[model samples]
Target: MINEPSAPTATHEFDLTTAPIESFTALQEARQEVFSSERAHDAFQRTIRGLQPTGPEGLRRGLGAWMIGDYEGACDALSAYASDDVASFTHANALMTLKRYVEAQPIFKRLAEKYPGEPKAQGGYAEACFEAALSEHGEHEIDAICEVYERELAAAGEGFADSAEGQYLAGRAAEVRRDWQLALDHFGKARELNPAMRRNLFHLGLRAERCGLDLEALVAYQQLASLAPVDLPAMMNLGMLLEDLGRDQEAAACYDVIARSRPMDRRARLYLSDAVAGMDMYYDEDQERKEDRLNQILRIPITDFELSVRARNCLNKMNIMTLGDLVKQTETELLSFKNFGETSLNEIKEILGSKSLRLGMGRQEAVLSIESTQQRYVSGENAEAMNRPILDLELSIRARRTVEYLGCLTFGDVIQHSEEELLGMPNFGVTSLTELKEKLTIFGLELKPRQ
Candidate 1:
């Protein structure tokens, strides 16, 4: 017969200070020690079996299970704990790691609110908020989550930096979410406080590159290359960044170091070819000037076209910065933006139209023809090639031209000519015929067939 572990035997009042620190404390601490020692999984499991399984013991057993990669076992043991703080936090974390975000979120939030001083709980809360924000569509809910995390971290007291692990976690989360500046700041702080954390240098370099701080990124990547161990991600990343910055010889040396360890890596070989090509295409001064000009243009603030101050404020909040930016977007793209509506669009269009502009790309033919013709007229110029006699008129130029060619110069002359006679003219097809009839019809002059 299989034997099952007995139920919670000791129901004594839980004391934070004096509760018999379960035998599993030693076991939990041992698992951590074993993990730090970098022992094999089976050896760690043997150490776990030596601990007594009793009250508040479940927490250690669960943590041991977590350390040994048994997520389910960890969660089960953690759920049966006398103290909810650590076990609840660990259980929620296990759920999160298993991608059960919905299940983990509430538990994390509860723990965060209950143990506000605990950095692990705060980190878990931030993770839950981020996951929730990601599920939100259209609006950038991620920004709200980031602000929440930043605010909470600022509020956290002495234990905030107890582990550089929280800093690394927050930094990585910011990086994956494309918040480059935030990622760099967190990684930079983490590296400064814990210089032994070689990975932070690599992350700092990556985020620096993305945020357009190239010189800083190059220095960071160089440091990472020097400090990182064999098979380090930083080594490859450093070489790529150096190659991108047009230092081919230095990049080749870095790649050579990586190739020594990973000889058969096709990806590294391809990267070497790309690095060499990048050196050929690098243009320092010209590109820098272009970027400076672009940034200068981007800095110009757009005037509020919306008549009401309220509407303009709403648009500003939605990040609509320029008239040129507004014009490039379609009606659908405009409507899709948060706080933008038909009323705002109509008001903006009315304001722009008063200045002879539009909310969208203007009608090309109308604008171009008026522009070209008005200039010519202002210069006392005639665009006509020849003053031909009333024969061989181009039907495409003007309908009036076609009508005049058939001995129909005035409205009276048009009334006198039959539709069939006008149709007989060269290049005067049904399109022109229909257009003439429609024009005449508006003036109450009907075109009849000669028959």
Candidate 2:
């Protein structure tokens, strides 16, 4: 490693545990600087790296970890002690940062109850409860948690309602209740009060977009995108809106920022690619839209269409779980299955035909079936059962598809398909394999062992 100068130290050594909350304002400003100034972020990281996460310096380490966006480290380091309420707040905030909302709730609640006059504690409790409420399954449970949020807001009264943060909170609550106009109004007011406020700006842009105030949404997103320490989701939403408005160059810049930050974000990369393609001299707008439409159609789940029980069962057994998957199967393949007769065959053909597709339109070359190389031809009563039509087995679509899609024509053919082969088909997961095995057990036969 190259030798480097020491990280810049603070003007004065301060202990977070004993310091007033405002003592953090300078560091908060500095943290923002880290994003805008390359060397500053590196220095911040270096300072954080020098701190130990255990022993006497653990609390500072946790705080440093948080500043550097290492929330997991902050959670672990901060949890070591109940040093002070400030430290506890840091630990709780870290938990919330990592989306451990349930764990953060009680901490915020205790802090809120203990320091009833402290706005941060109350806000933290309300925010934590609201977030936790969204993850709850039962409607009543969600309402109960939301009730706490309402109570906390009500307790804040008129003074809180007058503030920017209060308006932002109220905007979110309105959104939860699906009061779109109210959400937009509150978010707008919050934006006016504090244009620099991060969350308020994002929600304002989102709520404005929902309300069809495109210009307003665009303005909010532009302002947000200009701020330091980038919000990836906000940037993504901004890019989408820009693309919709034919601002491909600007959209590409937004995507480029996200792509650089997260190299693994395929969506960002794809968006960037498309945006860049828009600038190409020979770009075909109509062709791009047709391709997009085709992709959308190909992604349609099989469940979206109505089919007769027999047809549905056949498709399920064939592991053809989407419209695209159905188009990949030939008439011969469908008819070859003992139970998949002309009526079911006609049903699939008609659906695909309506969508300008035909059976086997996209079929890959046939692969050799595991059955073809595996078992001996049967004889006697066992042989008779083996010769029976696959439909006679009355197996689920999953089991049926698993066996037949690999050229299984009868009960004997089904048994010839190995465990691994059966589990390899589209939408035929392990659970389906287990069910197939259990159903086969009723007929006194099991699948060929895994290869």
Candidate 3:
């Protein structure tokens, strides 16, 4: 028979000063130490083992567990000391770590209200509310929570603003507001303040990508991959960028590692196959020359050509900036716009004729190609099924968040995304991709074929 560990002593009046340090101070120090340590998990376990495992000491143990990445253990230990202010704050943090943002939001709110000057309380509340909003909460609720979070942060003052956690919270708030540049700035500051914040680096990559800073995004992802080689999301994103840059062999190597690590993952397998096939694909010089010509033609501005003032004014009013933009609009669309008459349309047609192109001519072949590909992949009842709303699928919270982020509301929208596109999203990991694939399999659907 095995003996169990002894139960906690019933004493509530134990002196925290008698320990290695005051309980709250010890908790804070332990959190910082673990965050900055190279061997964070080992350091966290060792710190918690040295602490007494009852009463106020439970608070230290709980915080250490949270710092070490043991979210469930943090919840269990912290729950016993929920009556204490510091413990309650850590408990809410643990809940957030477990992705129970809805459950943690009110707890964070209570702490923020009770301690209006505490940056941790205010920042935690803000982060929880922002996460809840991302998970599909109403805009009105999110706005109210943001208002409170801002007030509390303001009250916490400059000292809080300079802290790493504060910068991270500011980054998250900026992200919720769709301010990608501001989010990236805050995340960069946070990383500078705390180099161990790998998650912030990941967020930096995501925000940079969204803001069209491709080089910055690539560097961020590369740094993160170097720090954590087994980080599938970072590796996958790096591979996608490499492939887009025409580095097929490097992209294939990234996929090969993921495939080896996750043998059962169909998405990884598919990506590896595509990358390998790409390596063997012949370069089409004629196609390249054609694309180069098309790009040069498209870059020619409408203003570069001679036109009557009235015709130029009409095109300007319609926001027709380039030859490509003008060619994409049909005669009907141009005529329907205000003050554009048949004479102006004739003038535009003449300009296009000079270039051997017609209105709305560029999209026809592209649409046909897409239609043909769609026909090849789906048929009969499956085609109808593809129109169903993505919300109908029982996806996990992480998967749902990713689909929403991509603005994919229907099965068709989801199917249009390749594995690389899905994995390129921040916070979308192997598990989420696998879950999505399983759901699609139910409808006999898969990701769009690689180009």
Candidate 4:
């Protein structure tokens, strides 16, 4: 006969169907413990190697090692499954973490275009942009490159609305464009979508406030104060807005709260002092204005105007509780009061001149009059002669094109507008208004007729 092939004997084999899922769960728990334990990073290195060619199993193994700073293991595992978008994105990130920019570039570029609006794609593109900008170029050129990436990423906005990284990139891009409105919109939208996104809300509020969107900015700062832990900026911004809104009591409350929590807050203290000083100055200016008006009308030899009750109340807060206290300071010092503007400053100067007793008299005054003179105005020239809507302002060529698309032409048309109304315009967001506000503030102008 012939030697027949003997039947293969069965080795000890665990039936996968019969095995409890708990066994795998237990393994994962064990792996996590080991991963977090000191000196146990290398414990899984051999296990990862054994898991190769097992689909995502091998990727997981590679990721664990990579997370622990094992570049070789990460590359080995990640390279084995290079076509997987998630795997490729993760691997690209690992390379970036390792400062392997040159190696990470192509991988990210490939994934970004492939997955356009995905978080991973957006993040990868942003990183690539950063890498490109940092590579041996002038700062301005780098800024331009970064801006291009920002616009592209923002336009590719699915996951970006809620991503801190996305918001940050978008904001930076807007800043590069010098488009404050776009920056504000991106930052604000990010905060609205994800309240915990760090620092974006604060920046948005500050920039908005600087552009004269005080109400909108106040809301931003308040949200920031509530959402952010120990955010000094938010508190400071809140206090500033309260002061601006003429809510002295509320401002004092905000200041006290900040001071109690952080006694070393210098800006808070300065603001409080300024508020106190402002109140007193207002009263004094009113009294002076009154005296001047009375003297002018009666043809009496009066040196100054009398303060109104409202003005007196303001002065009391500033420590200018009386006329003597008022005369001791120059017109510029009085004009520093929050509500006291250029018009008030002129009134003070005229009164002092008439009295022949200038503030600080003979000595050079510490309070130099910074009162800017107004151009002579023909009566009725300030307001628009044509009661036509604000849509006729003749905005820049680009702005006009946009407005025409939106079917707008006059100021009255814009007055009743809300954010939703304006955003409906193609390519228009809060950014356009941000620019408009800046232009208006420059001319001592306001939107909505100062209501």
Q: Which pairs clash in model 3?
A: none
Better of 1 and 3 by TM-score: 3
For residues 1-451, what per-residue lDDT tens digits would candidate 3 score against the true structure? 0012234332121222243333343444444434332343354466678877687677767766765557798888887875676667767866975778887888778877776666667677777766776676556566666666667566665688887778988887777677777898999899888765566777888788768777778778766764422457777887787677555555766676688767997887788778767764433332243343354455577887899998899888888898778877766688888888878888887987666565656443322222212212133567556745566677898997777566464687788899999999989999999999999998888988877
TM-score of structure candidate 3 = 0.43
lDDT string, candidate 2, 139-236, tens digits: 55655665667777988645667667678888888877778988889988988887877778988898888778777888899778766556788999
> Which parts of model 3 are misplaced by more than 4 Å?
1-78, 81-91, 106-118, 134-149, 223-235, 247-265, 272-451
TM per model?
0.35, 0.54, 0.43, 0.33
Worst 10 residues of 1 by lDDT: 374-383
Q: Can you give the lDDT of residue 96 in candidate 1?
A: 71
Query: Residue 216's C-alpha lDDT in candidate 3?
Result: 79
Arranged by lDDT, best first: 2, 3, 1, 4
Off by over 4 Å in 4: 1-142, 151-168, 276-451
203 Cα displacement, candidate 2 (Å): 1.6
Give the clash count for each candidate. Answer: 0, 4, 0, 29
Local error of candidate 2 at residue 360 (angstroms): 63
Best by lDDT: 2
- Each model's lDDT comes to 0.55, 0.68, 0.67, 0.54
Residue 85 CA displacement from its true place in model 3, Å: 7.4
Across 1-451, the per-residue lDDT of candidate 1 in tens digits comes to: 0012223432222222233333322333333233321223445576556555556454566666766657787777776762555566667766875667777777877866776666556666666666656655324565666676667666666767545646865786678678777778788777777654545676788788877787778767766553312324677877777676555644755675577657897777777666655543343432343233233222334562335765587667767676545444445566677777778767766754443334444333123222212211111121121111112232355565556444332344455567777778767778887876765565555666566
